[model samples]
Target: MATTYRPPRLIIIPGLHDSGPAHWQSWLQSQFRDARRVQQRDFSQPELQRWADRIASTVDHAGPGEWLAVAHSFGTLALARYLDEHADTPIRQALLVAPAEPDKFGLAELLPQQRLRIPCTLIASQNDPWMTPHSAQRWARRWGASYSNLGRVGHINSESGFGPFPLAKRWVEVALARAAREQRPLHASFREWSFAI
Candidate 1:
């Protein structure tokens, strides 16, 4: 049977400094045409409220199919906050990567963020200079997402040397396939004539 596919809406939320050209998020966006970065007020000064608002708006505006949220650094925490605060939306899955330490990073207020029903996965590195493995695991527990502890891969950003993550693509593909399966069937609701299956 021929399959119907809706290219997943990819929301890439970058943390503290916002992803530079060399960051993995930027690389992913260039690789996949549909991916986008959630516009932020300021990454240099890190504003949670602004980031949350932008994320929520982007999520709400999503037209169809599943939402695959990918976050790096503090972006992961921002998506977690959005998920916890809103009960409406079609975010199917999240891939949280390399979350920085809330305390050390001075984002202590966002530490106790709530969890949501969305399925998520956290990929963290053992020797990440910004965060501890144990802390990332804690984030996974609180967010109720599966955890992948990649050993000795510092931060998994371009700084740590990740240009095109083909391995990560496998995981993303599985998530997208699952989303296509669970998504509501698309219909020609406003069309006069539609192609027959």
Candidate 2:
């Protein structure tokens, strides 16, 4: 008997204050019925440990399937922490966008210093107030993720006019399609584009 293939499930991790209905994360979730967004009890207070715990809990209860995470801003840091702590995580690939500076929250020492185990893509903007493009690139190197510069998009949020981000949708679709075709764990880079700044 041939075994059936199960596609990777998407786990959406929004940033501080949560992604509003008009935010790209919301739009992404609306597009995928299998996607689940992480819900923090107190979005106002960004306690790293608490946020990481929320991610773990979500993953633990997410049932059986491979996971692909899409995280933004502070949520990106939380997802990194979760990945670092859990070496046996079900997550195969991740797309981190506009990650907030770890030093800003005094979390530089708390996060993993080595490259992450799984494949990842880190997206940064030239004019994001939360993190500089240089800092984003450095972190991407540390995380062993491919870095992509969006150029001058402020934080890549709704206020930055990123409603229904088609690029993000494309990234997810490509990843899913590749995994479905291969019928194995994704060990390849998902970098669609990268530019020197």
Candidate 3:
């Protein structure tokens, strides 16, 4: 008898204003066969509770199999909050890029202060106005997530010229490969593809 392997579903959680068509997140979604983007009701508003609730709703309807999430900017904050509130989550691993500072939205105390149980990688940039690199590293530590600094890429969004980013694609591929090899929940071990970025 042979066993079947299903790749983790991709959950694309974009930021406050939503990822534009040219944004890397959008490009990442296009590369995956089983991918779903979380749609916020109002992209212009910064309602933390509503945003976090949307994340939960999206996950609830994600069907079957574990999920690998890629969230950017304010979406990272909402994802963190969702993970904090829901201990038993379907999200096996996450790639949180250019996370906006919780303090900027007056939500520092609302999000998880302790380490997150699920494995994640947090990529930061030296010149991202939304969050300082130091703050990004600190939050990575707080969430028990691996951290990477991308030098001076601004916010790692469309404005940063990050359309069709190969690194993001490679990261998801490596994660799915690792999950298949382990035959367990997905874990974040990005050392193999660190040089590819």
lDDT of each candidate versus the true structure: 0.74, 0.90, 0.88
Model 2 lDDT, residue 129, Cα: 99
Of candidates 2 and 1, the better by TM-score: 2
Candidate 1 lDDT score relative to the true structure: 0.74
Best candidate (score: lDDT): 2
Number of backbone-clashing residue pairs for each candidate, in the order shown? 0, 0, 0
Model 2 TM-score is 0.92
Give lDDT tens digits, candidate 1, residues 15-133: 88888898778877776677767878778866676788889887667656557788888887778777777777577677888887777757657644545568777888999988899
lDDT measured at residue 46 in model 1 versus the true structure, 0 to 100: 65
lDDT of 2 by residue, 104-196 (tens): 999999898989878889999999999999999999999988999999999999999999998888888878876775654473544433222
**lDDT ranking from best candidate downward:** 2, 3, 1
Off by over 4 Å in 2: 184-197
- lDDT string for model 3 (48-99, tens) is 8899899889888877678989999999998998888888898888899999
Q: Which candidate, 1 or 2, has the higher lDDT?
A: 2
